[model samples]
Target: MSDLAHLPATQALKLFRTRALSPVELMTAVIERAEAVEPRVNALSETMFEQALEQARKAEHAYVHGEPRPLEGLPVATKDEQPIAGRRASDGSLAYAGHVADTTHPVVERVIAAGGIVHARTTTPEFCCAAYTHSRLWGITRNPWNLDYSPGGSSGGAGAALASGTATLATGSDIGGSIRLPAAATGTVGYKPPYGRVPAMSPYNLDHYCHDGPMARTVADCALLQNVIVGPHPADVVSIRPAVHVPERLGDVAGLRIAYSPDLGNWEIEPDVAANTRAVADALATAGAVVEQVEVPLRRADVMRAAFIHFGAIFGPMVAGVADAHRDELTPYALAFAEDSRAALARDGFLAGLELEGRIYAVIGDLLDRYDALICPTAGAAALPAGEDYVDTKLTVNGVQLDHYLEYSLTPVFNIAGRCPVLNVPSGLSSYGVPTGVQIVGRSYDDATVFRIGAAVERVLPWPTRPQL
Candidate 1:
């Protein structure tokens, strides 16, 4: 059962097809794994074991009758931030700890409709605001690779669960580096599809920077889950038309133009991270792709400012409204974020951010025009302490003080230029055993290209599927 828990969705599906694996058996293994690891990592905020078992039984029936659906019998862990109709959606806030969602997010609905079993709801930082996953409502979500370090958030739990073999497939939402950061830290694969590529819940659905995508142990598995969740939805006005299908076997990247940036022009990347990133570039080069070291016209300050400005202009107010009603119950970080957002809004920071984003995109657009794809270190540093918060912590990369904790993460830049698709693939492990990753950034709406490059990289520099949990 423990071994069964670690099986990839692709392999599990094959087993299901041959009747070598039963959905009930798989779900039971996953639930047992979740129970065993829950105390150490605290990855899941809510468990739906019985519900999952019931679903799994139905999936087994489907398989017996040869009527299996797309994601038939697979166990998936939903990020706590997303709603699952009639289920508790704390969003990692004390205010919503007892709240029940009336309707499901279109992506989760798609997962369920495709026969994916939702066994657990993973944890997130309060309001899904922080990079490290710890909340007043759900406690802290730790890295399975190294328990002292964070798995990364706002999709931290999803990353941890996947790494710990507690879930076969997990859903993640990326705004800034939520999906990719954890994916990098936990040695997993995460995809941040282009804006509107996957439907999101209201409010965030229209926000270009916010995206819902897949997290998995392997690139092919990630693509499998992504294919199910993506596509147009009438509920989300911004959802893309005519969904693009990603191939199960994303073949070679031979003869493709790939550009690699070590620091993105300003970040102070740790030695291990830089080495691993360069190694990935070398592997890509050796794999028959033309990989070159290039500097992107980006500054750490510009990226962080743009992300905060956008968050302040929109998410800040929404969180503020919640804070007003439950002032005392809010997390310290959440309060600080609200206060900072208010200050940014007062100075017309949103418009300033837009101006800077335009300049940043101009440079990125030119780079993408010349190169088929871009690759860079996903996080400047490998990992941080599990409980570290953006407010109190001082992040130092190579002895230089960072302006903010998120400065280490290069993902927010893509959110500012939200049309591009980014995939985070594991590079290697640091001395501390925490994994490092590189982001494969593609041209605007060119989802297939990034996956191709990522798939190529994955094949050349294969990573361990599950963490040492």
Candidate 2:
């Protein structure tokens, strides 16, 4: 019998359906892998071993009777932020450490309804504020490929789990490239469906930025999970109401109107990242995509400043109050950011930031009307050194000192637009052995287009499987 760790969720489910492998057997392998790797990656804050086993046993009974749920017996991972009944859903912050959820979130409920067994909750930055995953509660989530490098956050744990074969499918929530960033950093497939494609209730900002998405080893698996999670939910007023057509086969990229933007026309990019991204762009053209280097007239400084300004305004006050309440517990950076945000607010700076955001969105909308899709590098560079915050580092792009954390540049464009579907597909590997990816941003409500193009690009330079550490 093949080891359960080697089986993809789809294959594992097939085996269960045929009575070839029992859910108990699969659960055993999953738990063993989690226990073995948890110390290394700091991926799981809490493991649902007993609960998962119980659920799997029930699922095995159902399978024997030929009454399997959509995701029956399939083991999966959840982001720490996602509420799972009776599981501690810490958003990777010490403030909420050991806080258990009485009721599961709607997204988790949907996944369970599809027969997916939730075995563990992955790590995230504190309250998911930063892009690199490391929390006082969870320490750090290092990339399985290279322990010296980080798995990008706030979905860093999900990306690493999928890459390391710890889980076949994982759930991720993206606000500003949270899903795609980690996927790019860790060499996994991540999809940020259109803003309302999946149900999301953000206690932070509901205007249009937050989205719940799926991360997987392949595009089809992402589609499988997406098909189950997506649909109108009363909980999410903005959830897509219409039925989305799930593509079964995304063959060839021939005759597709593909537009590639190396730096989205403005931000400075590292040479190696630029070259790796270009190789993927060229592959699209070779595969029959009418690829053209498109110019998106965007002011990089304006967008980044607006995003951070808005981010600070939203999170700053809350953070300050929390720190004031527990001054002894706040991280130095978080405290500094709170003070900075208060200063910005005093200068009437937040209003200007909002206006800038409006202008940037208008410009992007105009560009999408002309081009079918836009492509760019997923990150300024590959995964940075693990455990250290890149914000403190002076990373250069093209001999130019990047102003903000370089990780935030490539993403947040789609977050501001909030209408397109963006996917991070492995383009190539950086010199550091960490993978680099390209971002595919499709037109408004045209999520399938992005998936179609991403699957096509994934065909040319697919990521290789790495066994669990």
By lDDT, who's the top model here? 1
**How do the residues 272-389 of candidate 1 rate in per-residue lDDT, one tens digit apiece?**
9999999999999989999999988789987777777888888888889999999999988888888877776677666787898899898889999999999999999999888878
lDDT of 2 by residue, 1-469 (tens): 2257647677777788889899999888877877777788777766778989999899999998989987888888988788877767656666666678886776788898899998887888877766788867778789987888889888999988887666768999987889998998888889888888888764632657788889988777778888888888777777778858568776777888777888876887777789988998898888888888878788777776676676667767777777788666655556665776676666658788778878887877877777777889988878767887654576666677766673345888888878788888887778878887789888888878888888787677666756335
Clashes of 2: 2
Kindly report which residue pairs in candidate 1 clash with one another.
none
Worst 10 residues of 1 by lDDT: 341-350
Candidate 2 — which residues are off by over 4 angstroms?
Answer: 1-3, 243-245, 340-350, 390-392, 406-408, 467-469
Runs of candidate 1 with Cα error greater than 4 angstroms are none
Model 1 clash count equals: 0
Question: Candidates' TM-scores?
Answer: 0.98, 0.93
